[model samples]
Every structure is written in structure tokens, then in C-alpha cells.
Target: MSPTLRSIVCGVLGLTLSAAGSTAAAAATTIAGEAAPACVQYTAGWRYTFVSNGCDTVQQVTVEYRDGTAVPCRTAAPGETVTFPGYGTSGNEVLGVVLCGTTPA
Candidate 1:
């Protein structure tokens, strides 16, 4: 093949491969079937709230408050628990615990 034609072909092939690899990675992140229920637990106290990870794997969690604010994501190992202070007057109150992605802060 001519030099120019060969270079163009190689470039096209490289782009195709890169696109396919990225598509596969994106698909892998999507849940294929019913997602497993979150295994996180929480307890609200007067001054703080306790969040626990009951799953067998490490999990990232955020404490959601009744005021629609949430704490920064925290990582917890299996059977580990973490604490976050209550928010405003009337002790804001913990509304729920939510699973978070492993993205770095």
C-alpha cells in the first residue's frame, strides 16, 4: 500500500479500537439486571448519626439529612461504621443513607 494510504488506514483502525474499548467500559458499569439492595444501616442520635456498612465489600456512603443536605462521601469496610455530626437546630436529623460511587474527592 502507498505510504499515505497506509497511514490513514492505521489511524482509522486505532480510532475504531479506542471507541470500542470505551463503549465496553461504559457498558460494564451499567447494572445488567436487578441491582442488589444496599446493605447500609444508620442510627440518629442527639448530636451525631452512625452509618454502617453491612455488605461484604467496601462501600462508599453519604449521610443524607432531612434538610436536603448531605455529608461528603465516606468509605467503610465490611461491618465498619462511621459518624457524622447532626446539622442545624433541632438536630437536622438523618433522613437516609445512600451508596456512592468510588470517585475520589
Candidate 2:
């Protein structure tokens, strides 16, 4: 598998397992920022609400998992409401998300 894909998978699996009830990592669970911090995973898919921004703005997203799997995603438009199910199992604090432009210059 590619390095990016591997990273995302590892991160997702790690989060999923911990969310189910891992006592050693109680402080690892995290959801940060306001107004759609781009690249945040639905790992465990909690009922999270955020103000949509840059609607109709096409964008690409790359997420790196704890184990180094990188998952790539994109939006057709800015400020779009996307529902990505099975994003990952929410079992710990989210590390971070990285966003990139969807279109080429």
C-alpha cells in the first residue's frame, strides 16, 4: 500500500480501537477548533456541528493517521456540507488535518 493510505488506515484503526474503551489513553481523545477545522476526521462519527465556510469552494484534503496512513478527500465546492461515514473509529484525541487546493494551477 502507498505510504499515505497506510498512514490513514493506521491512524483510523488506532482511534477506533481507543474510542471503544482504551483506559491507557484517556487524554488522547481530541476535537479542536471552530468553523470547520479542515481535515478533521469523523473517526467514530460523533454528532459534531460546525459553521460551513467557503461554500462552493473546491478543495482537496489529506489526512495522516497515527500509524502514517494518508487519506485523501476533496470537496466539489467551498462551504459544502459533506458527510463522510466510517471516517474512523473515534477513540482518542485527533492529531491534526492538512488541507490543499483541489485544482491545479
Report the number of the highest-lDDT candidate: 1
The parts of candidate 2 lying over 4 Å away from their true place are 1-56, 85-93, 101-105
Residue runs of model 1 more than 4 Å from their true location after superposition:
1-38, 102-105
Candidate number with greatest TM-score: 1
Which RMSD does model 2 reach against the true structure? 13.7
lDDT of each: 0.69, 0.42
Deviation (Å) of 38 in candidate 2: 7.2
Candidate 1 is scored at a TM of: 0.56
Writing each residue's lDDT as its tens digit, candidate 2 over 37-93 gives 543333324342222335345544433345543333434355454433223455423
Each prediction's TM-score against the native? 0.56, 0.33
